[model samples]
Target: MSRIQQRVAEAKAAGKKLLVAYIVNGDPQPEVTLPTMHEMVAKGVDVIELGVPFSDPMAEGPVIQKGHERALVHHTSLKGTLELVKQFRQTNDKTPIVLMGYANPVERFGYQAFATAAADVGVDGLLTVDLPPEEVVILKDALDAVGLDNIFLLAPTTTVARAQKIAEHASGFLYYVSLKGVTGAGHLDVEDVKSKLAAFGQLTDLPVCVGFGIKDPTTAKAVAQLADGVVVGSVLVEKMGSLEGQPAAAIATAVGEIIGGMRAAIDSL
Candidate 1:
């Protein structure tokens, strides 16, 4: 199995849903990002979805938009993000890292070159938010050649035909947008999300992870019962933004508390 599949499967075997944490690379400051990542791993984050800061992150709301702005001030490029992953892998190699961003950067970075750099830096997956599966053939082939998983997102508005198409293209896991709006825009209705996941489950065996509105321990635990993974984004980014000038340990502590609480809640389920 791939590193992502192994880690996610291990969570399943343990009777607990995986906790996937998202952080914008170089947010607040570049130096603190890696330490904060390690802290999340220590506090029970099963997988890391590192956001590659982009100029136009249409899928993000205010909280994540602010994060991208902060990271971009330091000029965090696609190559720089890959360098951060390489630094991260020097000590820790087990936790999977998924690069979540837009397609413009990858296109500029050259598809083949980006895939090779990503694999060399220990990146396990890619989720280009704006890339539809119909246009994903070349990029998907490049990623497949390098043994990296290409993740796709499905939304509540997606029709059955579209869902099947996405499922066919998705590799690591299928990220199901639990709401109709952008990330951090709506209140997550657990029942509605459950029904959507149930329908997708019948279409493919790919792990369907719910995201976009999961903000707290209560919601995380509730969603954990229905999906293979739970992804928390804006809330954590907000916390990182709040700790801008503070020490690295402070950022770690603040983020760790939120993830640790959700971890406890999911395990108890």
Candidate 2:
């Protein structure tokens, strides 16, 4: 089974909800994003979703947009992030790494080559923001050939038919966008997220991970009650403003401490 599936299954068996964390690759540069990715897994993160920095991020909010800006200033690219993952797998291969970003860059890199490189680097899955279910076939088939999961996102505004289609094609898990706006917007209505989770549950058996706008332990816990998994990004990246030396983004640092506390909150429920 995929690490993602195994994680969700174990969470289900243990009566716990999975905690998925997202971070932009090369935020402080490849040197930093690499170690930070490892730290996240070592500290109790169930899965890692690394964002491939893009020029025009339609789905990203100001925070992640800022991340892309910083990462770009360091001159990081898809090749760099995958290389980081290649270096990452030298010691650890069990932790799931899903590259989340836009489709233009992937296509620009050649779909087949991208798949082969991701598999070669030990990447477990992908979540391309602008790649819809229909357009996914070109890359999805290539990914499947390499044994990589093509994870997709479903939004609150998505139609039931669209949701089913996305779920049907989804491999690792279904990333359910919690709200209508960009990531780190504001005030996520738990009831709205719960309603969306119910909708995804009706469509597929894939582990549903709720992301975007999850701010703290209380919010994460509330969403976990309905979601099979929870993904937080903006906050963790925010924790590293104006710092040096790995920026404390390692999963074992302050970010991990917060996630540890959030996990506690989920456990408390």
C-alpha lDDT of all candidate models, in order:
0.92, 0.83
lDDT of 1 by residue, 1-269 (tens): 88899997898788889899999999988987899899999999988999999999998999999999999999998999999999999999999999999999999999999999999999999999988998888899999999999999999999888899899988989899999888888798999998888888899988888899989999998998999989999999999999998998889889999999989988889
Give the local distance difference test score of model 1: 0.92
What are the clashing pairs of model 1? none
> How many steric clashes between backbone atoms does each model show?
0, 2
> For each candidate, what TM-score against the reference?
0.98, 0.94
> In order, what is each prediction's RMSD in angstroms?
0.8, 1.8
Instruction: Give candidate 1's error at residue 74 in angstroms.
Output: 0.6
Q: Write the per-residue lDDT of candidate 2 for residues 1-269, one digit (tens) a residue.
A: 87777777888899887888888887755567766767777667888899899999898888888888878888888998899888888988778889999999999999999999999988999899888888888998999899899998888899888898788899888988889899998878998888767767988878888999998999998898888878989987776434434544453376667667777887888
At residue 186, candidate 2 shows an lDDT of 87
